[model samples]
Target: MSAPLAAVPALTAPKAPKKLRSETVALDSGLTVVAVRKPGVPLVEARLRVPFLSAKAAHPARANLLAEALPTGAGGYDRAGLAAAVQALGGDISVSVDADRLAVSGNVLATNLRALLDLVAALLVEPAYARPEVATERARLVERLGMARARPGVVASEALARRMWGAHPYSLDLPDGDAVAAVTQAQLHATHRDLVRPAGATLVLVGDLPTARLVEQAGAALADWTGSPAARRVPALPASPGGPLLVLDRPGSVQTSVRYGAPAVPRSDPGFPALQLANLIFGGYFSSRWTENIREDKGYTYGPHSRVDHHTLGSTLALDVEVATEVTAPALLETHYELGRIATLPVTEAEVESVRQYAIGTLALSTATQAGLASTLSALAAFDLGLDWIAGQPKRLLATTVDEVSAAAARFFAPTAFTSVVVGDAATIAAPLAALGPVER
Candidate 1:
């Protein structure tokens, strides 16, 4: 005879987040600095966020080159000399850019915090953009972009963005290789002058130090780097009209990539917490219904995920999955089945409680370290959010009712609301997929 297994334990609610001491200051030069005293290791983290969005068609290539060239040489040092200076301070630095902003982020020894600030100031105010350095980065960027476009996932993402945002700047996730090759050092210098100024930007510092002293150090270092970027309006996100599935051809691909998207609420919306929880229950986690059905039960994919992607202009609910080409049609069929089920039926109390605990626990874990906290705060700075919003999220999650989660699921998870795309061997997938719905070639 075999013994019966014991019942699983019930989950307890998450505790309130710990309060940390922090300060914010706006300097006369139009920069916002936020400092937080989180004593753990003997290190500090820094993030500089500058608004980089533009309506110009040429902005993407110039912005890409400028981000790559920022740390190559600045002030009096070349690339190697700049690296040596930062390494001598027990630090590391890197630059990155996207559709919305350009960010320079790194960490350093707590005692050398002021020195790191000085280096950042130099990079912002006096970048050299040497001819040789810019030429090398431009070639490398072109090659990298060529390689990226060859992948199936990149092709599908580009198609989805085009369908979702139409002619908006958001549609162009990666710039054209020809445009990147055409960028000149002079153009990059002009881009730096126009978009990389300190005005309408923010700096975040977190580590073992008094908040007030950290703000003063930053203020003194960045005082001279001041100017407003050229004014350009970000057009509102166009409505993502749901229609026939768009089938893009990638000849001889063994796997099929499926992308589906719908409109979603931002973090500031009153219904955001419930919507977040609902997404987790649907496909945001490994234990979610969509994953359980498509991956575990049907063996269609290794995993599938859904999430709320936030942008400055709007937010979207996105779902992504890659399955074997032979199973493409069946996979999408099961996906629609699951979406329809969740949107029409009320979720159980157990499901809601499970996701709530997961959400709160993950948030607490993400902010437990200094680097993590610095990055989190910097991303939130785009929306004018700070530590107060982070500390108060657990309470909001605890108070959310099962009814709220169900309502949110019904509203956001409806299958009819999605704009879907599939990238695979059109010869094999087109007919079967067309049987499910109207598919545009």
Candidate 2:
């Protein structure tokens, strides 16, 4: 009395919404402002990206201290004063820096949008990196870094970054504690002076508002500020330490965290759509073949997922899984097995459609929420893109043929193309992993 799974009606992607009323305004200070009106929620989300680059002596810790200390005091207000002022306007704010740029984001009721803009713009104009406050934030950051480094998942991803990026600033996983402790308020000020500038920044506002008014508000708040020139370039990435097995020794550990990845393309690449679907079918979802084979069948990991991640500097196809220390090698073997199958086999149309629906449905859901739309648009701004491009994504996925997904899978999903590192008790699992392939001590 039930229809066969194959006989089930195929899933359809949601219709693309009409493009938002949008405009780009170039402020006098050289910051590019993108505004879009969605007009649903009585709320507004604002995202600011100020360019932050690494120096010859790269110190992520120093940059982080600068990021953390900004809100403690800015625009003639102490840290608590800033928090109180922002909260008074029904808003919250956060700041962080990566190899590419420094990000500042916050949300507020639509009625308080101007107040939020004023506070953020003021910080940009005159950040108070006071000496005592810098010391306070520095100590707390160092303590948190120690706890983060102890987790195997963190350990493995940091290892992946190191193996993926050699000598480039991207390779530094966490900031050095001693380096952090040595960071002075003068350094934070210096970093801000050299980096955070309006000319090198992009600000995005999305929610219920007029695009022109949004731009006007942004310009008024930031008009007097100045930033460095816009000619800065990200250091070109070096070649990945090619497909090799790296084993990191973590003594007396109960589980192994394995991270595998390969260089991939960015959002601008034409192949991005097919590659995204290929990733979905591989391990981007719980029902993906990689998950069905390893997590559901073999019970090697509770969470096994993959993604095609894009950063300003580059992109990668990466997946991670955790398994019992004793089964570390087995888990890696199965991961490769699934990867090989996706590369060589003729995938069923049904499999392709299933992933297609999930991908499209997720995009719709993510953009439906105000917070999600703001985050999505802000992330796109990092790549010099905007909302129209994202609105067309469901079409691109729909246009992907079975043959195309199959070809993409073969081209990008091959197991042999990956470089990986296993983090666990080297004494217990090193020999077994070594027997499987080349294992670095």
Tell me the lDDT of model 1 at 225: 94
Computed on alpha carbons, the lDDT of every model, listed in order, comes to 0.92, 0.84
Each candidate structure's TM-score, on Cα atoms with residue i matched to residue i, is 0.98, 0.95
| Candidate 1 global lDDT | 0.92
lDDT at residue 396 of model 2 (Cα atoms): 88
Candidate 2 residues 1-441, lDDT tens each? 996577656555477676778899887788999888888878888889876766446458778888889888888998889999999998989988777778899999888888998899778878999888988999999998889998999999998888888777887767877788888988778777777888858898887988888888888878877857434455788766656688898899999999988888898888888888889989999899989887889888888989987777889899988899988888888887888999999678988888888988898899887778878887888787778778888888889899988888998888777878889999999888877878787
Best-performing candidate as measured by TM-score? 1
For model 1, the superposed segments whose C-alpha errors exceed 4 Å read 1-8
Question: Which 10 residues in a row give candidate 2 its minimum summed lDDT?
Answer: 226-235
Q: CA shift at 253, candidate 2, in angstroms?
A: 0.7
